[model samples]
Target: MSYELRDHTADVAVEATADTLAALFAAVAEGLTAASAQSVPATPGDRFEVEVAAESREALLFDYLDRLIYERDVRLVLPADHRCTVAEPSETDRTDESDDPDAWRLAASARGVPLDAVAAREIKAVTYSEMALERRGDGWRAYVVFDV
Candidate 1:
């Protein structure tokens, strides 16, 4: 899993890639954390857990990133690193509840120090502009824009 910051006209953008959905989510979380502050302390001060569900993959990514932003704003903490697990319903796991039976679920844990420990920048929200998540030849890639 890896992430890189891209230049945006009025906000911040991140591109992340990984071999699996869970790793992709974790990489994006790390990207958002890196964009929110100049530096994070080496010590892991606190751990925050997040769980989110959405009907589709795109919605799931949006909600997941939004939750991370909410955690940063409300808790005044910078997520230095994260681990995520995504449960995407497979054919065997699907039921006949709806036409699209594959519901996406994500559970994540983030570790970070207080925002006061470093120079911080406020990320207002995660935006849909230029957002994308797709499969490559061997892995998945995601691009997200943040309202800074």
Candidate 2:
């Protein structure tokens, strides 16, 4: 239903839940805002198209956030609403792509922050070392950490 934020040693902890994997990923975006409050806005503005590929749902979640961290490091992106469509790799697949990923990428716009603009937060990275995505009953749940 909603993303929850928690305190960590040198970063922030995030969690979200949904009825499906796609929804769960979307919730994680909201959780990011809570973690990067210094650079993120209290109000949302624009939503961008973001596409990512990975081997598993957990990996997918990690890759997605790590990509965001990359953008953040590059000063091109900040935390905001994200709508993700997740799919697993096929058994016979060699090269990895999330559903022909080139066409499945997403674009998000932040309400309070601007990419490549001025920011004061020091969120260094989003790590997959602790990321998790699992189905509990009829809903999906996930957790991730951001290096601040």
Off by over 4 Å in 2: 38-47, 90-112, 115-120
RMSD in Å for all candidates: 2.8, 4.7
Cα displacement (Å) at residue 120, model 1 = 1.0
Best by lDDT: 1
Prediction-by-prediction clash tally: 0, 14
Cα deviation in Å at residue 118, candidate 2?
Answer: 8.6
lDDT scores of the candidates, listed in order: 0.87, 0.66
Error of 2 at 143 (Å): 1.4
The residue-level lDDT of candidate 1 at 136 comes to 96
Candidate 2 lDDT over residue span 1-148, tens digit each: 6788878777788888899777787788778765765544444345445567655566677777777666655545565756667655544433564345332233333333565443456567778657777899999888888887
Please identify model 1 stretches exceeding 4 Å from their true place.
90-101
